[model samples]
Target: MCGIVGAVAQRNIVSILVEGLRRLEYRGYDSCGVAVLADGMPKRARSVARVADLDAQVHETKLDGATGIAHTRWATHGAPVTDNAHPIFSRDTVALVHNGIIENYESLREMLRGKGYEFVSQTDTEVVTHLIHSLYAGDLFAAVREAVKQLHGAFAIAVLHKDQPHTVVGARQGSPLVVGLGDGENFLASDALALAGSTERFIFLEEGDVCELSLDGVKITGRDGQAAEREVRNVVAYGGAVELGPYRHFMQKEIFEQPRAISDTIPATEAFDPSIFGEGAGAVFGEIDSLLILACGTSYYSGLTAKYWLESIAKIPTQVEIASEYRYRDSVPNPKSLVVVISQSGETADTLAALKHAQDLGHRHTLSVCNVGTSAMVRLTGLSFLTRAGREIGVASTKAFTTQLVALFVLAATLGKQRGHLDAAQEANYIKQLRHLPAALNSVLALEPQIIAWSEEFSRKENALFLGRGMHYPIALEGALKLKEISYIHAEAYPAGELKHGPLALVTEAMPVVTVAPNDALLEKLKSNIQEVRARGGELYVFADADTKIVNDEGLHVIRMPEHYGLLSPILHVVPLQLLAYHTACARGTDVDKPRNLAKSVTVE
Candidate 1:
């Protein structure tokens, strides 16, 4: 998942491009570069370092221009070195930056090489630059148009011609690209956050759309080779500046923001409405007898948690699919099943493609639980509930995960009411529980000091195991993910029942076993599983409800939760695990926010 920022303005835009890259840093990148059309030539500085380092190079070289393109590259086709950094030039005429994969680059590279074009970098993106340069006959737009026709795979590209100053051409195919509107200027970026501070008006380009940005105006051409009309909507930007405030890291700050995030996602009012999803969502809910949830990464875990909520509370048969594998395998499709896709960015490539695949199979009932209202997933789905988690800067999601659970719980309650499983009084009690969530989350945050103490031991461990029974099993998986993502520890999760089967073989005194113990129906079975772990001399760190009766003893660590939140215990139990991962990563001296070999948004397959 790379980032692209381009601007054509009357004033010098080098600083603007660099600042835009800074905003998109949360998306994750290993290399960065800026190419500007200075003095009628393409001049660029590349770095396999942070954006700040690239900015320093730009300033040291005095690389300023009125029109430019910038990129933050997350290596996919090549090593994240200066040679493979984006803004790859061809014949010194075209400077191009691309996000996403190009599948047929091998053949194209060979063809271009036979035609006397030299490839300096090992990248699929370089093929496009050569193709554009080969097709260039003074019109950069037409060259880009023709070049894209012969290309395969998903990409968002921004190109600038050395001969064509005060203009930048951008195209998107199966990837996100937006145009920012400004007086006497126009902009292009892989995400709106890049242009947040510069402009308030944006045009989210459609798939296969090509945009031409000039000093005074912007033109859009659809895949049909005709001018297309796209809505220019006003949007208020958030998280344009990545301010940590009093927190040490973005991950820590986001963990503390969960209280406000959940409150914003669901209203405290006692009334429940299905129409919050969309205008026709009530009718859609009434028609569906089952649910099919699709997502990837942490969003997939959220979907798994919702499966428990939907089947128990809504009384609907539910199935959760890992989006990447769903489309590749044959599966049963029910027209009556409401297909729900969950994503924090709303632009996850696999999830979006899976939604489209579901539609192709005649599963017309679709809903999106996402954070970005303007994301393509929301636009493509029939119904949507936008989570107000703001911008999740950390690559490992915190507030987004809790807010998604809030939305899913709301959806489940609404479905339960529609199916006659819940009456007015029951719904009001659910509403009351939701009203107390923010305060409960605050109380959970209060346990951070204790969690930090637990993290000191976790930091020294090389491997760990997490366990949970029933609904909390997914929370265990999420906890394992958070630990491995940031702390670089090898961790795995198992349903407590499965521990005696295979995972028990890995347990030892050197192994740390983290258990999510809530006073639910599965408590007795979970306790039995804990005894098995303890018998194997496995160290135990349990986050138990206050009344679970689990306590600290020799070789046993227990951190009591605030209270057992009946249906909402998963939301409360996950907080300490998150803190555990954050603090452990801090202790291990690993990159907590931007972890190794990961990106915040999975824009490419």
Candidate 2:
């Protein structure tokens, strides 16, 4: 995934483009470039550095123009070098910036080469710039429209032509693209975060929609080449959400925001109701006999945790699958199964594709648990539960994962009530537990000082292990994921019962084992698993409930949780692990927010 911003305005657009790239830097930050049409020619600046360095270059050279397009790239087809950066030019007449992959670029490159066009960089986007230049006949809009018809994969592109000054053309196929409205200017960006203070109104383009932006107005065309009207809604940008207030990293800030986020996600309700999902959710819930959860990355772990809740509390059979793998394998599709998709951005490409695949297989009862309300997953699903987590900017998710768990717990309780598995009194008890989550989260966050000391030890190690049982196994997996994501450490998680079978062979005095020990039904079995590791001389670091009676001794380190939350311990236990990862990354002097080889959003398959 890459970030793109384009502007056609009455004033110089250099500052606006630079600021937009800074806000959109979370999408990609491998290399950045900007192209502006000035003095009847295209002036360009490129950098194989961060956005701040590129901004400095732009200002030092006094790059100015009324029309321009900028890009921050996460390289897919080529190395993260200056030549492979976006704002690629063609015949010195046109420049373009692109987001998704062009699957048919090889054939297009050969065709363009036969037409006497020489390629300079190793990128799929260069072929698009050449193709657009080849089709230009004094009309940039018509050229973009005709050129997109030859593409074979996902793409969101913004183009600027020297001949068409004060104009910018953009198109989208499978990636996200939005048009921003202003008084005497218009903007195009892959995300609305780029246009935060510039415009509050945005038009989210549909699949295969091409848009033209000018100082006068905007024009959009549908896939059939006919004029189309998409609603322009007022979107509140993440002005204060992106700021790093008093925390050293966004991950730290997000870890502390969990209490507020959980409180916002679970409504101030006295009783359980399916209507919290959306209108007609009760009908959908009544029609389903099973659930199939599709998700990727951290969202997948949250789904794994929800399966335990759905089966135990709701008395429903549930299956969880990795979204990227679900579409490639064939399975018996049950029409009565409710397909649930979970995502932080709600624009995850693999999850969206899996949702469509499920719909094609006659699974009509669909739902989404997501953070963004204006995302494609929300629009495509019949019902949705919006996680009020605000904007999550950390590459490794913290608040979004916990909020998803809260939303899914609400779903499980609602289904339990619908199936008669829970009576009125039981339902009220579940509500009481959900209401106390905010205070419980605050309690977990207070253990950061203890975890910071543990992080110092972890920073000196090259590998680690995580252990849990029952529903907490998924939380262990998430903890391992967070550690590996930011700290550059190799970590693995195993169900405590499964450790003796194979993983116990790796246990040694040099290895650190982190365990999640809640006082649940599996605690006794987990204690034996802990003895298995300790007997092998592996140092143990345990996060246990105060009532578990687990104490620290020689070779055993324990940090007591404030209380043990039955069936809801995963949400509280995950907060300390996030803190461990963040502080460990800080101790190692790594980039805690933007990890290498990873972007915040996965917009391409």
Candidate 3:
């Protein structure tokens, strides 16, 4: 996904737009561009690399204007080149910055070419500009609406017209768009993070909603030209403390901040009272026959962990599916089913699509556990639980996954209590354990140096195997994903008991086998799996709890984590794996923060 930002102001706005682009650079950094309305026409400055390159060019040849749009692209439809950058202009009149994919752009481009609409860039976004120019009828908003009507797929567009220099129009279908309120100025961005420095009040535009913004105010309207009303929400700004502090990168800072994030997420009895689930939640759990957990990427691992919790702890039949594949499948959910979608950026494209599909299939009860408050998934779901992970910057997801598990654990506990599967003592005990997770995580983080040393061995390895069982199986999957995502290592996760099925054949002295052997009900079986690897001469790196009597033998690398409550061990076990992945990537000299061809958020399908 790309990032889009636009500002309509009474004063010169180029600096503000560039600053907004800088704030949004975490969303994407492949290329950056800006278009400003100047002298009754649109002027552009763009580059194929970092924003600093474009900033240098802009400084040399200033394009002063009061209204403009900017974009930092992640390059979906075309190659990452200067010509393919955003701020795609239409015959030097209107400029557009788009943040999503245009699925029908190839056909639309052919038709537009036949109609004598010349294009310069090989991007789906360029087609939008040409389509708008071909359909202009004195109203840029109307032309944009009509242009989008003829197209298909996800997009959040910010269009500026040279003829109407004082105004900017924005619309969204499947991607995220938020309008920020400012004094004698207004802002448009793909997410709240881009506007956090300028505004706290925002309007979250829904699907098919169009908004025209000017220095005076903003007007909301629908695709059919009828006026629409939108709710203004207050966003808490991340102040100066938002910097990386003493850490080298945001990823490292985030990894170390997990303890604090966990502390903030787990609520006390007075704050998050158990009685809150006494209403419709109880009724829903009692009446619901089955459960479906839908998610993508790291969130999918969270859903898998939730499936184990729901099935074993709450005694509910649960199914976990990758959101992209779930929507296209032929299976039908029962009418009494509860669908739960977990996401950090709740705007994840596939997850949102799956949630919509479930709604369309007549699933009346749905819930979203997400981090963002006004994301599409949260707005569409019947209920939502916001995870207080606070702006995860790493593409591999460290804090968000743990927070999602915390939220899912809470949900599981609620359902278990409702169905009489958990008594008051058990519920209270789990809640109390949840409260101590932050401190336990703090203890686990102290082992980062040890894990980093272990990572040095992994740099020479070509492949690795991650093993766990039950709830820890999801942690194994997440660990493998993190390692593969940052280090380019070929890694796979298998349930400890399923090792003999097929994966055991891959074990060798050259391969490193990572086993999650935290003390649990299945620890003995996990030990057997480790023995199987050891017998095969596979180098073993075991993350074990301190009290667990796991012997340190030859060819075994052991890192002892502080003994945490069994239910909270997953949260602690993930820290060392994160460190291991980080150090492995560092040793291999890969881009740890911004991985190759991967954006932080998947805002496009």
Candidate 4:
């Protein structure tokens, strides 16, 4: 994924571009660059290092301009080199920063070559920049409009032309783009978070929308080159989500904040209200008989955990899919099924595309469980359950995952009531437990010291296996994912019942098989699975129920979960594992928040 920020103001915008790029750094970038229109030319500085390095370059060169476009690249078209960084030029008159792929760039590049245009970088972005410049007869806007017509794939682009010194042009087809409204200035960025401190007013660009940002205001043009009126609304952002106040890493802070985060995610009500999801949520739940969840990475595991709740509590047949695979594969879609999309940013490329793909197949009843209300997922869905996880800065996704589980469980229980599966007393009991979840999480947070002690052993291990049964199987998968992502360890998860069939072969004395043992009906089966691992000379690190009979002996190390929450057990069990991964990653001296090759949000496919 890449981050783009553009601004046109009366004052020099180099600092604004740099500050915006810093805000977008959590999205992840390897190289950064900026191009500003000053003295009737585009003054540009690029660096293969961090944004701060780019800022240093700007300071050294004294780059000054009123209109500028900056980019933080993840390096799609070429290697992570200075030349491959963005602000690829078009004859010094046109400079542009682009996110997403241009599928027909080779053909376009050859066509540009026919017109005697030469390229300096091996980037598809460069070809488009050159193409736009070549088409510039008099107006930059018209040239950009013509150039975009020749493009073939997804893009969110911000272009700066010397001819239009007071304007920055932005175009989006299949990527996230938004315009920030400010006094005597206008801004464009791949995300609204980049414009957080500057302005709260945002204009979310729709698909195939193009906009021109000037010092005065913004002008929009639709895909057909016709004028369009776009509404600008105030969308407040999570204040200081990137700041690691008093915590070593965001993962650690987020792990500790689980109690408050869960409390915020779950409403403080004596009884569960179906309307908590939104107006007519009960009606939507009443109509849908089945569930299909589309998500990726940790969000997929959240959906997997929800499957257990939806089937057991709501009696709805449910299936979960990795969003990337879901869009490409042919599958039967149920008209009455609720297609749920889970994402924190709500801008995940695969999930967004899959959400649309599901809709294309006549699954119109769509719901999204997301954190960002201004995200594409929420905008595209018919219903939404917005989590109060705030902005999850950690690339490993700690609080977001748990909060997602909370939202999903709420959906399940609400559906259960609507389906007549949960009686009035049962619903009241679950609601009481839900209201008490924050305190339960607080009790579990106290187990962090024990988790930290267990993490010391994990830091030394090269490989590990996480095992769980029933609903906790997804928790096992998520646990292994967190460890592998942050600790740089090779880890895998298996449903405990599948152990003797295959995964047991890798269970050795050196391999630590972490288990999530909740006091559900499957606990006996999970205990049997643990015995099998122990019989094979495998060391076991388990987060078990407080009253579980399994004791710490020989090679078995146990970290007791404070309680066993029936439907919401996964949310509570995940916190200790998060603490485990964070502390282990710290012990291993790995980047606990910005893990290598991992972006906080996957905005590109």
lDDT of each: 0.93, 0.93, 0.85, 0.89
lDDT of 4 at 157: 95
What is the C-alpha lDDT profile of model 1 across 1-605, one tens digit per residue? 68999999998999999999999999999999999998889999999999999999999999999999999999999999899998999988899999999999999999999999988999999999999999999999999999999999999999999888988999999899999999999999988888887899999999899999997799899999899999998987763466899999999999999998888999645677887888999889989989999999999999999999999998999999999999889998999999999999999999999999999999989999999999999999999999999888999999999999999999999999889998999899999999899999999999989988999999999999999988899999999999999999999999999987899999999999999999999998898998998888889999999998888887789999989999999999999899999999999999999999999999999
Question: What TM-scores do the predictions have?
Answer: 0.99, 0.98, 0.96, 0.97
Best by lDDT: 1
RMSD per candidate (Å) reads 1.1, 1.4, 1.9, 1.5
Candidate 3 C-alpha lDDT tens digits along 1-605: 68888999988888877777777766646899999988888999999877778888788897778899999999887799889988898888889999889999999999999999888888999998899889988998788778888879999999988889898999999999999999999999887877777899999998888899999999988766689988999996562335887987788889988888877777556333334433366556667978899999999998888888888778889999999999899877677999999888888999999988998898888888888877878788777788889877777799998888888888777777777788878887887888878888888888888888888889888899999888889999999999999999999999989989999999999989998988888878888888888898988999988777886789888888888467667778888888899999989998888889888888888
Task: Tell me the tens digit of each residue's lDDT in model 2 across 1-605.
Answer: 58999999999998889889888876647999999999999888999999889999998999999999999999899999998998999989999999989999999999999999999999999999999999999999999999999998889999989999988999998889999999989999988889998999999999889999999989999999999999999998875436788998888999999999999999678877888988999999999999999999999999999999999999999999999999889978999999999999988889998999999999999999999998989999999999989878789999999999999999999999999998999888888999899999998999989999999999999999999999999999999999999999999999999998999999997889999999998899999999998899999999999988889988899999999999899999999999998999999999999999999889988
Query: Could you tell me which 10 consecutive residues in candidate 1 have the lowest summed lDDT?
Result: 235-244
TM-score comparison, 1 vs 3, better candidate:
1
User: Evaluated with TM-score, which candidate comes out highest?
Assistant: 1
Q: Please, what are the lDDT tens digits per residue for candidate 4 over residues 126-229? A: 99898988888878778888888899878899997887889888999888999999999999999888887789999999988889888888989998889998
Better of 1 and 3 by lDDT: 1
TM-score ranking, best first = 1, 2, 4, 3
Q: Using TM-score as the measure, name the better of candidate 3 and candidate 4.
A: 4
TM-score winner between candidates 1 and 2: 1
Assess candidate 3 and give its TM-score to the true structure.
0.96
Ranked candidates (lDDT, high to low): 1, 2, 4, 3
Between prediction 2 and prediction 3, which has the larger lDDT? 2
